[model samples]
Target: MPDRSSPETRAVLRAAVPPARRLLPVVLLGVASAGSSIALLAASAWLIARAAEQPPILYLSLGVVGVRAFALGRATFRYLERLTGHDAAFRQLASIRSGIYERMLPSAPDGLGMLRRGDLLARFTSDVDDLQFVTLRAVQPFVSAAIVLVAAVAGLAFLAPGSSLGVLACLVVGIGAAVLAERIAADRGARRLAPLRGDLQSAVVEHVTSLETLVAFDAAERSRTRIADLGERLARATRAQAASAGAAAAVMSALGGIAVLASIAGGLPQLASGRLDGPAFAVLCLVPLAIAEVAAAVPVAVAAWRTARVSAERIATAVPAEPPSGVVRPPAAAVAFPSGAGAPTLALRGVRAAWPETGTPSGPVLDGVDLDLAPGERVLLRGPSGTGKTTLAHVLVRFLDYGGSYRIDGVEAAELDPAEVRRRIGLVEQRPWLFDEDLRQNLLFARDTASDDELLAVLDRVGLGEWARERGGLYAPVGERGVLVSGGQAQRIALARAMLADFPVVVLDEPTANVDPDTAGRLLDDLLDAAGERTVLLIMHSVEVPAGVDRVVELTGRG
Candidate 1:
């Protein structure tokens, strides 16, 4: 078992199982299919016995025909049953994936950032695939197995009440064997499998993302060695599960064989004495074996459950659910900074935030820093590296947590809905993100409804109108992460996105770092001209401050 004492693991279990209420129909269908299959098997034995006896030729042919129909009917129902169960599994997996992504949005950046890209990729893909298989196969097989066991008992009871007791005893033995197999194999299997999956994913992701680095460093062999290790771990887990399942199957089959042998030995005398029919006696023997076959499948299914539970728990713990409905408010607003001391547009006071892995400290990244600005005020934040300039911007946006108060427009920032809070601030990070889509779509990311004229106007404002026109206008594809465009073009396109946001405040960080000197100069000129009606807080590293009557706050000192 996992260390459920960890709050993160507990949270994951809670989230994964919450929406699992939809699994009821899947259970019902599985039971119905298994029960029908058992019934058809028993009917086939009876029909076969009647055909062997010297009955009318037509009657024997009819019995053969009936067996064929029964087999076909069982196949049809089995297909439908599996289809319904798998469909639910897929939907639940999607919900779990979505939940994990939502949780990552608000998690500690340091903690989240520490995770390997390959591990997360494995979780979203193969781990998710395992979940679908587990939910559909694990629970359904047990459910269907139970139904088969119960129906077989009922059939035996109707044909020969005394024999039903022996069959029930076999089921009891099978259940115990299945439980033992699950207990012995699950934890070890999960331990081996989880890391194996994560490593495999990490290896592939590392190779792809660091292809340039790898080739530059001449380290392809090292990567291949690591992948081989991961494969070995996966093979070990597979072998362990297979061995446990083989043991369980052996035990269940032995018990079932004993039950069938005992029934035949005890009932044949009764049949010879005319107390039981040969046909009914034959069914009693065959039905128990059929139930045993299904019971044998249970051990494999249980082993899968181990892997599934681990996957579910991992996803649940990593993803954050929607917090309770009411908005949470911090106690007080930050002190207004000396610059533009009017009603503060954004403020932070006595704030501290850190990872759970790191104990809460008196000094956070923001470190109780106080800042304030008025509407339409252009403030440049110039700080030495590692002084939490970016962290402060995130705190202002409420993307990160802090100890004291952060507020917008005098109201505590926490009081406002996160979605509503974001609407007021337009942010640009150092790296400009462009999609594989057309230039127009990348620019109008959150505002798809913007008309072509509206999009062109914003591009013009960011000094990209002529650039777009040169590339066949807005419809030109930028390729993935704007690979088709130059670094300067990518930045301009990002600036166009921020400009079109039309929020009252624009926060841009190191926008010119990636651009050429001429493009950077032109971009600065256009941005200053377009800054006519908005508050622009720029965290600048290189580009000189636009010549304007605005205050500059220099952040210095270190931890």
Candidate 2:
């Protein structure tokens, strides 16, 4: 299946930009910088011409001063453009990161589960950083350089027409060669980055997540060796990219030399024929040198262009496992689950699915499965490892594709809209994630606008109200993944977040896996008690199902 976010990702990213009015200052700065570059070149040429004519001391001094001021102005504009452009790029990247994350929440078990932690980190850090180059440097530098080149050519033509035309022709050829070189190298660059980046990310994830295990098993050396191997591969790939960029740079330099030579050849003949003077001839030669700076940016532009496309392709391939098409509707109109008997029911009839990579055709994880849960039914799903319990949970949430028919209040689950399915269901995975923020922010995961009263109420329901109050309540930081809180407390916080969603269906994967028996029982009681008006689907491996759960179902086979 293709990712749904690809086609529209560019559009979504663009929407994050500031208004045109806000960008006008940046554009004006670019114009000023370009004009300054041309002026600086022209002044330098005039200074050289005067030095040769009679070496007028006053003109020489003034010209030097003028050139310095021009350079300063150019530098100032360049800095301002970079500052504003990068600022805008970072803001847009933040918005893009958020959007991608939001889209992945419900589709996580389907697509995100397939990604390594390090690769996903790359998406937020490296890939997003690459876009800064694309948005700020890639396009802007080319535009500014082109403008300066055009202005320089015009100034040269006023002094020596033949030389100006010669330089322009050479520039055209140089650009063409650089573009061709880029095209030839782009595919190889992408291919080289693929396994190399993937391997590095994979190794980093494995090493970091298993650091304790590796040390305990005395396998740290082995892990370090594997990381070293990945680093070497990455270095080789980077070298290849650099080599291609170098070739393009060489081409630009060679062409610049040819252009300068042509200018000199044309100007010298004009000077001998009495059509040009020595000072003017020297000025004409300076035109090509000024134009060369513009050509120098070509290689960087090419590299940035290739990198942006590769980054886009990587992100597009990862999110939205299946392409988005028509608007996705909910599985049920109103808390419908279990099927025929009405009210709100969820049921699966022989649903089957297989992981794409392994190509292992397992039986329908819920093989000929039949389930019925009424409103307020807190059912505990019991199964052993590899029994497809997790897979079943994902299907219930509409993340994975299923073969057989599954219905929510008679509506086919497949026909329901994805966003609607998500809005109607809340999930608490085994490893519940909490961002590095305060408890208040974490509790508002689904409802950012949730009131203080609502937040406090949910916290109290999860049995953390008193503890949180003592620790400063909402203002207290939770650290990364609720590290500041105890395992049982984190579990309760996660439950509170899910409960606060007020969704019709709530799903959890081994919520008590890390909690003590007493806490686990208390947490279960809190969840079931609060679920008075909602349905709960608890996925657990242990046979110790919570007392008073509405129902219990067991899976017999491993698929």
Candidate 3:
């Protein structure tokens, strides 16, 4: 575990704070609201005491107006405070989430393999959301309470100095004791709750994703039991936290009563000596109750601080300060891609690379690999499992950095920007992802300006035109992860996207892996024909070579 006050954690926490301009209004409104509350209580106390003396109706009329005005101000200011405070907090949350996402991108795909999907989702969604409390529960309340407490004490001092000092002393002691008691009772539970909640969420996500496998293996009941156990632990921790907060509130209430008694005792002498009027003494005794209400925010603010600190630490841990070893980072100064005509030639000699790994390097997954493809040529790359064929594909697209010479049209690939290299070469993975959207949406992302007719033409080239029309043209849903389409149809859809992208070179890695042998042959033929004049590097394992390929290369596992 890292320190909660680490620089990374501090940076994350700082990002949660809204700018001073936006936050100033929220603080001002909070102060006005809390001040109105204290004033409301004092005015009501004075009004009642003054009425008991049978004063002129004129004096009572002013007190009546004061009471109504303070009451209305309290409610109105509170409403404005809540509105502005939440607005600023939510806007800051958007900025923080965007910053976190930007940080995650430099180490994505390969470097983030260490994080589980479910736990990562929790960090992004739940942990980031907790940061809003920095403004809502901690900073705003703490500022408002401090300002109101000082004003209340000053007003009391004007009426009865002795009672004022007593109230101030009681407030300090009561707040300190209440915060100490809450920490003692709930500190451990508060610290454990964030991680416990993440664990339970991860378990639930894993169970749901693997429900079919669990049912097939007769382990579904066991998984259910594990989820139940995690849920129970989370519930227990939540209850403990609530109990501690309750204890703190109880302490504050008792202290409020004690302050009232102390004020009354101190004010009696002044009242008897004609130093203080009856209404003044009443104000002194009763104002402590309102001040205590303001001071109650202290314990709640402390608790919010604890939770926010934990959440910030978790966010920092999830997104590392630097990209992991073997992950490629963009160069500080990169050259433009070389100008070329038609398709560009790709050549690789003595290229060695490895996937990202934590700690010490485990040597290269691909070593001493040599290959080349001329413009407008088609090549088939064959290898058994674990031979790094897919690794070679990743290297070509600049997804992973490599050691030796890989050139595009006579220029070193490393000198060019990664984004520039990707524009020239595209890859369709072994398991191509289709968005849970209609056909046009899925294809439009590759080339957003492409018309429906162009999309349909590309679909026709990939042999999905008739099949797409039968399913209601381009409006039919692909379902989540392409569940609505057969494996062969999914491959065709991916190929259609590649065509829309219009890359000079495309690498197809195991496109026929999911389809049966009968469909695989025809699918390969259709894909190759659609590729036409573009350079193609087709990666497969133990599949018959489709016709019209210009060359064949094989990778031995030794590399």
Compare the candidates by TM-score and give the number of the best one: 3
Evaluated at residue 172, the lDDT of candidate 3 is 92
Please give, for residues 201-264, the per-residue lDDT of candidate 2 as tens digits: 8788889778889999999999899899888878877877777777777788788779889888
lDDT of each: 0.68, 0.72, 0.88
How many residue pairs clash in each candidate at the backbone level?
Answer: 4, 9, 0
For candidate 1, the lDDT comes to 0.68
Cand. 1 TM to true fold: 0.82
Model 3 / residue 454 / CA error / Å:
3.0
Better of 1 and 3 by lDDT: 3
* lDDT string, candidate 3, 429-531, tens digits: 8888889999999999999999999999999999999999998999989988898998888888988888899989999999999999899989999999999
Best by lDDT: 3
| lDDT measured at residue 121 in model 1 versus the true structure, 0 to 100 | 79
RMSD value for candidate 2: 5.8
Write one digit per residue (lDDT tens) for candidate 1, span 26-125. 6766666676666667778877787677788876676577667767767777787778777776777777678677666655343465567788878777
* Candidate 2 residue pairs in backbone clash: 328-417, 329-417, 336-344, 336-345, 337-344, 337-345, 337-346, 338-345, 338-346
